[model samples]
Target: MTTLPTSTQKKLGLVIDLDTCVGCHACVVSCKGWNTENYGAPLSDQDPYGAAPSGTFLNRVHSYEVQPDHGQAALVHFPKSCLHCEDAPCVTVCPTGASYKRVEDGIVLVNESDCIGCGLCAWACPYGAREMDAEEKVMKKCTLCVDRIYNENLPEVDRVPACVRTCPAGARHFGDFADPDSNVSVLTAERGGIELMPEQGTKPVNRYLPPRARDRTEDVDILAPFLDPIAAEPQGFMGWLDKALTAMPGGR
Candidate 1:
């Protein structure tokens, strides 16, 4: 008789708190550190110090200014990466059978040794989740730090993914999404969390809680740090430098 494997007791996943994110890059850096150290090859850089800089990363934080044409500007910083979809297109499209989902905990993984680097999985993803490792010649994306999460050798508090552990603002979380009582599930429910590109219907497991609204006029300066303002062309030494830089001496 044909029989499917029994699902595990938990479906592990992540829930991100946009309200608390503070747009810090700590999670990004932590992800880089962990993935580079453990994944087959480090996230490679192409022309890193040269023009047209690019690299492969499993996680990237995207800063967006979400202003409706008639409304106030709301800045949103999204950390983009694999959502590890339940109906992941990346899995089915893998001609080499490298991409797979674990029925045990629902975390998707790529078998790097088996990958042929066809990039079919990359095209199947609408979120642009997958990237090719130029050096390894294989597909790469988030593993959710699978080795760390289930490692019995680590301390209980450090068992989560590196990104979740290093987030200074407590913006990221890792837990069993199948358990409604789990922290991830509860937080998602409480915040009325949203999923990105839901229309694509990949059934992404990650959730993003929206940021709280700020009073446009009163709280605008709260965003000043991100804007990086400098003294506007003062009438002194700095002003001279600024004018020199802007006008370019030989220019008309």
Candidate 2:
């Protein structure tokens, strides 16, 4: 079994905003595209065009309908991936030492060459973040786009996880948690970000900003002003018309 470092030089992770995410799946598509093309093995799809399509993906978004205490029900989009926990169970469970975390940036990764297609890591991950690539017969998980983040050849602005760059709603943020003044740190502090399953003691570096309470509409009449009569009584030409109509035998 592998052992984790006592401390990482930098705690690099993501901060996902549940309120801003629209469940567009753009981050999902971008993660699949970048990892398959640039990372280790290509993520394969089984019977992609057929009925039961299954594939390996590092990132996924789940939506839930939740009723807040102060507002009506709301739909929250939650994006999940490897949290790169400080005490990652997946790393400790790997018998071959294939799964490990980087001391430099705290990014957990699998050495595909050493991987024996064992499902131990998947079972150990409580968040269900790891997946077995059917075609490659190897375990796959999020690397935080290591190749992209540290590549000096790329533009400075593009040196982040593909999911963050491609997120249309700007719900994903990547930064160093070790730096108190970092963007992710400040955002997490301001938004009151919470860790996923903190009781598990994984000490996940990633944080999630909860969705804000929405306004209640059950008691509000949006059209009340427009629906009100312009005048209590008819005036101008309409008054004469009303008098003329009242004079008719059938008029009310």
Candidate 3:
């Protein structure tokens, strides 16, 4: 079994804001695009043109409808990837020395060259972080864009993971969680960020920001606050359009 370092130099990972995420899947698309071409292993597609298309993607998003204790039912957009746990089960379960955790940056990575594609690592991961690439005959996962983050050829600002870089709603932040002053750590403290499944004892580095409270007292009309056909005009096209819209269900 692989043993983790007693203390890592830095816990570098992502902090995602569930409240700000719009379920747009921009992070998903961007992650697939960049990582499929440039990272450790090319995320392969198996029978892409077939009726059932499946590919090796590092990031995924799932939407869920949930009713919080005090708030109305809301659809939550959840983005999932490798959390890179301190005591990663995938690393300990690897028969080959392919899976390992870096003591310097605290990033868990799989060496494709050493992987045998036995599927033990994937089965060990409770978070569903590992995926086997049939084409490469190896397991692949999110490496935090390790190549890009440390590449001196790229600009300083362009070093973040593809998912963090392309999020339109500013929902994703990347930084060192070990540093209390880092943006990720500050955001985690301020937003009450939570680990996904603490009972598993993985000690995942990535954290998720819970949904912010919604104002139930503030009554917000869905579609009627701006309709005023009578005040605009009786004969104009604007008046006619407004009247037509107001007649629809919940429009007024």
Candidate 4:
């Protein structure tokens, strides 16, 4: 096993908001589209068109129904990716030193050319962030769009990770966690952000903002009319549709 550097200069990572995420999979697609091309190799799909299609992806979103002991069932959207941990066990488990963490920015990455595909990194990660590319026979994980973030050719505003840029709900955020005043840091502090499976002691840089609290005291009327004033006051688009329906041959 290898050893990580004593300390990283800066911690650049993401802060995901579970409450705001709608599980739209926009981030997932954006990450795949960008990373597959940004990095040297394309993301692989063994049986893309087959009955049981599967592919390697850097970003994954999962939805879970959490029924608390004393509260209502909450639908939570969880987005997972390489957390770029401080004491990354994935780095220490690499026999060939292919898996390593950047000393300057704390981004964990793999040297594909030197990789042996031992799957040790995947086993070392508690969050299940690593993926295996069957064709390349290499272990892969999220690079945090390292190429995009540092590319000077791209527009100034478009230098973020594709997942962050394409998140329709603004659920994903990117910043330097080392800065206590950074947006990611403030949001984490305010929202009580947490690491996934922290017991593993990886000290993951990426933080997850738990679902926010909502008021459930107000009751919703389940039997309410679908359309309000549809026939009583025909005014706009819905009114025109209602009027046309009434003027049909067998109209009511």
Clashes of each: 0, 0, 0, 0
Query: Which ranking of candidates, highest TM-score first?
Result: 2, 4, 3, 1
Name the lDDT value of residue 197 in candidate 1.
88
Residue ranges of candidate 2 with Cα displaced over 4 Å: 215-218, 225-252
> What are the Cα lDDT values of the candidates?
0.82, 0.94, 0.90, 0.90
lDDT of 4 by residue, 130-210 (tens): 999877788878999999999999997889999999998999999999999999999999999999878888899999999
Better model by lDDT, 1 or 4?
4
Model 2: per-residue Cα lDDT over 1-252, one tens digit each: 389999999999999999999999999999999999987999999999999999999999899989767656788888899999999999999989999999999999999999998899999899999999999999999999999999999999999999999998999999999999999999999999999999999999999999876655678778897897678779999999999999999898
- Candidate 2 positional error at 52, Å: 0.8
Using lDDT as the measure, name the better of candidate 1 and candidate 3.
3
TM-score of each: 0.80, 0.87, 0.85, 0.86
lDDT-wise, the better of 2 and 4 is 2
Considering summed lDDT, which 10 consecutive residues are worst modelled in model 1? 1-10
Name the runs in model 1 displaced over 4 angstroms. Answer: 1-9, 68-71, 215-252
Candidate number that wins on TM-score, 1 or 4: 4
Candidate 2 residue 48 Cα shift, in angstroms, is 0.2
Query: Looking at candidate 1, what is the lDDT of residue 242?
Result: 71
Q: What is the lDDT for 187 in model 1? A: 88
Best by lDDT: 2
21, model 3: CA deviation in Å? 0.6
